[model samples]
Target chain A: MTYLLKQLGREWRFMLRQRYVLILLLCSFLVSGFAVFTGLAEVAQQQQTIERLKLADAKDRLEAQAKYNDPGSLAYYSFHLTYSEPSNLAFAALGERDVYPWKHRVRMLALEGQIYESDSQNAELAQAGKIDFVFVISALAPLFIILLFHDLIASERSSGRHDLLVSTAKSKYALWGSRGIVRFVAVVLCLMVPFYLGAMISSTGFLTTLLVSIWCIAYLAFWTVLSLWLGKKLASAPRIASILIACWVLLAFVLPILSDLLINHSVHSAKGGDILLTQRETVNDAWDLPVSTTMDAFAATHPQYADYSYQGEGFDWGWYYAFQQVGDQASTDMSNDYRAAAAKKYTLAGYATLLSPPLLLQRKINRLANTDALAAFEYEQDIRDFHKALRMAYYPWLFGQKKFDKTQLTSLPQFEDSTHNYKKVQNEQ
Target chain B: MNNKKTQFAIEANSLHVDIKNAPILRNLSFQVAEGEIYALLGGNGAGKSTTLKTLLGFNQPSSGKVFIAGQEVYSALDFIRRKTAYLPESATLYPHLSAYENVQYFLSLADIKKSEDELNQAFQRVSLQESAWHRQLQTYSKGMRQKTAIALALLREAPIFLLDEPTSGLDPVAIDEFNQLVRELASSGASILMVTHDVYGACQVADRIGLLRNGELVGEYDAPENGRIDTEQVHAAFAQRKAL
Candidate 1:
């Protein structure tokens, strides 16, 4: 143990003397620090947006409640705020939160259009992505690792010190092993110190933080071992570095992109825009159709409301709501297909991670942060569930089964995020 | 030359080494007894460095065996390395580090600790200028870097030494100082095997000189009872072998 410590200490001191090495380590620290800062800011911005929208939603609903005497008018005017609150660890990953709509304000209208409204906006921006901690680790940390380790052995040989150092050292571990460990530890520390600070500030759970650290270390070990292995086979530092950089490019960028294209081609599903268009067109066409047609379609799903009659000649509230319900029902099949395709694509990407370690790390941390595509899909489902609660609360009054009472407004359904349940289940696992 | 002991500190017997299917050393045999300096003198491609590397276990012998301190090199590499200190043709110690730091780092790599005064003494013994001791090797000349490497090797205090062109870049004065140091190390019971093309330098310091040509040891010469080996005789042999 004493010998190992001495060897490590010696290499640590030696590494500090090299300006290029110190610069690389500093760059790693700064880049990772910047990533953590941006991630925290982004998550804070998202939470702030959610809080702001909640206030406005409550105020708007109270005003609508004051203006409308009837349940149908109130349900039509009152918008409930549904949002997936960013997880504590989301400050690190910020995964699909940028791509998926995490917050939605929906009224008792056709649900599909409201859900898919923001899908196409700023997609290019999201694709470019924010500099989150996970991006720093999975994508950028490997390059830092490569720069640090690719020349571990070759540099010694180039300097004509390989033979002397090897022959003089008491053991191989005392020489190369110590040097490699020192470098690996330095790079890992540089990359993870910022993340740990972020975790503390975000109050990320201990187990999640540990898991993120283990995954990052394991991923870095993959690069470290690979660089050393290639260094052994190839004597030239530049050649070894070229091979490692090529590998980084292939795994971090090319494979993920190609697999995405292949998965999209193979997995057929309705697009979000298609779902929105289908629901909107159905709602538009309902104006020309007979009221009976809309009510008949709605009654097929809600048989309990079938006995209610729409006696009003022009613009009955019950008929208007029934047609809106029918519009959602018309697009239900397309919505399910879109979600199923998205789920399949996510699953296929999970398998592709075996080919690309960076993708695997990104996926793992994103899942932990509750910002993955799975999390986004769950949020959409939560909105749908909340919409169903809204419809249930108002449908009885619309169908004349219950008296319209302003005092009962306090008992109306409110949007509650199901992300807590998901997190609970995740923690248990 | 008279203080040589019978116990061999380094031994290579019938050693064969092939690199990329080309023979680097062929059936080579030699021994350096305790308190003796043996120099392998040859021109380029004569496999002198290869022979030195073989003794250090950097290259595995295709056949036969090498032993340092009476232990087979391949089976006891850690022991061999601990017992040996090597000086390469070009002592490219970390250029970013001062001479003191490079010596300290390499000695630490050997798991040997030295007091600051001891380090200063080793630098002083190598005759590296006091002014250059704390300067980074990058700013130093070739001879200064070589002196730093010599200081590191001396600090190892190992039983065996392997020197590859140990005086390749030194000035005439520095070369004489290095030769004197080698002689002093040998007198202090260390065994050394140096590979160099400098016939006169080898004759000046070596107790015994081996002439190598085309991976084979062609001739061996020993100093007379009270005199150094004749430099003219060895130089003639080297020149004639080049003609062949």
Candidate 2:
């Protein structure tokens, strides 16, 4: 053990003297640090946005309750805030949150339109992606490793020191092995130290942090061993570097993009805009249709309300709400198809990750942080569940022809995000 | 061969080496006894460096055998490396390190600790200027770099030495000084096997000289008792062989 430490210590000091090596390590640290900083800032901004929206949503709902005594008017005017809060580890991954709506304010209206509203605005921005910790580790760390290790043996051979160093050293471990280990350890520390600091600051769980570290180390080991192997096989430093860089570009950028394109081409789905348009058109055209047409459509879904009749000639709350629900029912097939396609695309992307380790690591870390597409889908489902509860609570007062009381507003349902509930279950496990 | 293996510090018995299906050294053999300086003199394409590399265990012989200190080189590579010190043709030590640092780094690689004073003494012995001892080798001339590498080899204090074009960049005075050091090292029970194309340099210090031509030992010459080998005879033979 003493001898091993001595060998590693010698290499450590030797590596410290090279200016290019020092510069590369410093650049790695800076890049990793910047990524962690941006991720933390993004998560913080998201949490703050959720908090601000929650307060405003409460204030708006209170004003609506004071203005409307009828259940239908109160439900139409009040908007409930539902949000998927960032997990403690989300500051590192920040996965699908950038592409999906993490928070939404919805009234008792057609919900598919509200859920898909922001989807069109961020398609271009999502393609570019944020500089999060997962991105730094998966895509950029390999380049740093390739730069550090691609010349481990070739440089010695080029400089004419290979034979002399080989013959003089007591063991191979004392020379090449120790040097490679020192370099690998240096690059790993440069990349991971900032992540660990961010993890501590975010209060991430120990087991999650450990899993991330293990995965990162394993990923880096793949690149390190590859660089060293090619360095040994190849004779020129420039040639080895070129080959490694080409590999990085292929695995990190090309494969993921090609697979994404293939998956999109293979899977067909209804767009969010189409669903929004279809639902809105149905709701808008319902006013010109006969009263029997709207009431019969609503009664098919809600059989208990079949006996209830609207006595008022115009602006009856029950009739208005029935058509609103029928609009959602009209777009239900398209909405389901849209969700099914997204879920299928996500699963195929999981298979595609086998072709790109960077994508695989990103997926794993994002799943750990509960910032993946699955989590987003769950949040969407949560909004739907809450919207259903709201309809159940208000339909009785609306169709029963009973006198409305303002005090009964307390019985209205609140939105609870499934992401938070999932987190709670995970913590319990 | 068996008798020589027991008495010699370095031995090659009918060694053959092939690289990429092409023969480099064929049935080449030589031995360097303890406290003796043997030079393998050859020009370009004569397998001089290949022989040095084979002895250092950098290249494996396709057939025949190479032994260092009576043990097979391939089987006892670590032990052989520990017992040997090699100086490459150009002495290309780390350009980013000072002469002292380069020597210190190489020594530490061998896991042999040496004092600063001892390192300074090695540099002084090699006639490297004391002023340039602490400067990075990138700022040094070729001769200065060669001197630094030589100082490192001397500090190793190993039993066997393999020198490939050891004095390639040295001036007349430095060459003479290095030749004197070689003699001093050999006299102190170190075996030296050097490969070079310099006829005069080989004649000056080598106790015995082997003439290598196209990977084969073409001729052998020995110094008379207490005297140097004849330079003119070896040069004429080398020129005659080159013409053919």
Candidate 3:
């Protein structure tokens, strides 16, 4: 152990003397620092956007409250916002959250229409990839690793140090292994120092920070091991570097696209927008049907409302809500297929990630941050549950013809997540 | 050490080698005594470098065995390498590092933690300039890099030294200086096995010379005890043998 430390010191000094490598290391740190800062800025921006949405929703609800003393009109006009607030560690890994909707505004109307409404963002940007901390460490760090260690063994052979060093050491591992380790640690630290600062500033949990640090180191090791393996196969440093860079391009860019194609080809999921459109077409057809027909359809699924026998209906709130419920009920099959396909695609993509360490690690980081597509789905599901509770809570007053107490609005169902802790943002106006 | 124990610092017993399905070395055997300077000479195709590599445990033989310090070369390579110093045909010092740093790093790699004074003494023993020790090896001439390799050997304090074309591209003065350093090492009881094309250089310093032809030891010649070598006759004999 002592001898290895001595060798590590010598190796570090040797690396420090190499000005080009040192400059590359500095560049690596700069790039990662930028990425961390940008990621945090993105998370902050999303949080601010959520805050603004909550304030806007609160103001709109107040206007609805002034117009209606009963439950039906209030339920229809009051669009409650459901948001997936960024996790504490999200700054390090802003994954699918950029492309996916982190917040949704929905009312007591057919939720199929409002639930699918996502923020307008260019998805091509997400596919092109982001410059987050995980992106820097997992994708960019390897390039620097290749620069630092591409010629590790080959250069030793060129310099005529190979034979002498080999004969001097107890074994080949003792000499070259120490050198490999030193270079690997140097590359990892170049990324980690900036990342650690970002985590500290963000106040990332100790366990989360530790896991991310391990991921960064493991990613660097993957590249180093590959560089060394290719070093053994090729004779010249340039040849080894060329093959490694080719592999980087393959794994980082090409393989991920292929994995996406494979998952899409295998697991064909209909879009949620399609389901929403179909539900709307079904609900619009309810305009031609009699109010009795709509109530009968609603009473079939919602047997609890079956016994309310007052059907003197000329567009009553109870009759309109019955058809809205009927619309959500009629599209259940398509909605389920859409949800199942999404889950299957995510699972298959995960399986495909085994072929690329970078993707696999990014997936791990995304999970830790709760910023992935599955996290998006979880948030949407949470919103769906809250919407269901809102409809159920509003039904009692509408069906029984009982007047709604304004104080009871405080007890209504709210969108919730583990990270979500929000108070009602009442308008000052 | 007794006579038999001290007689053979290196020994090969009917060694045979093949690389990638082609025979590289035929049945061969030779030995060099402690405190003796032995040179193996051959043409380009001859296995001179291969023999040195074999002795250093770089090239594994298909059959037979080599012994260094009475330990089988392959079985105890780490031990053998730890005790042997190697100088290859090219100057392979890390160009990014200064001469002193290279020496110190290699010393540490060898698990030899020496003080700066001892490292400088080794450099001085090889007659390397004190000023050049701190300069990057990239600025040094070919001969200077060879001197660093020798200084490394001196620092290692090994019992055996393997030289592969040590004076291949040096001036007469540099070659003489290098030859004198080897003589000093031999006199200090280090066994030396050198592969070279310099017949005159070998006869000038070597106690004995072996000629290899097509992987076999074709002939062995000795320098006079009076330290006189007839380069013309040695050349004539080598040329005549080649003609045959």
The predictions' CA RMSDs to the true structure, in order, are 3.6, 2.7, 3.2
Rank list by DockQ: 2, 1, 3
Off by over 4 Å in 1: A421-429, B1-7
lDDT scores of the candidates, listed in order: 0.89, 0.90, 0.81
Off by over 4 Å in 2: A401-403, A420-429, B1-5
* Candidate 3 residue lDDT tens string, A255-351: 9889998888888766777777777877898888877788898988878888766547466788878888888887888788888998888888888
Residue-wise C-alpha lDDT for candidate 2, range A1-429, written one tens digit per residue:
999999999999999998999999999999999999998999899989977887788888889888888788898998888889998889899999989988888888878888888878889988888999899999999999999999989988987889888888888878999999999999999999999999999898899999999989999999999999999999999999999999999999999999999999999998999998898899899889998899999999999999889767788888888988999999999999999999999999999999899999999999989999999999999889988998888888889845678888776777766684234211100
- Tens digits of per-residue lDDT, candidate 1, B55-126, equal 888888999788788888877788888888899999898888899888888887787889999999999998
Q: Residue A410 in candidate 2 has what lDDT?
A: 75
Give the backbone clash total of model 2: 0
Docking class of 3: medium
List pairs with backbone clashes in candidate 3. Answer: A159-B92, A160-B92
Candidate order by lDDT, highest to lowest? 2, 1, 3
> For all candidates, what are the clash counts?
0, 0, 2
Candidate 3 global TM-score? 0.92
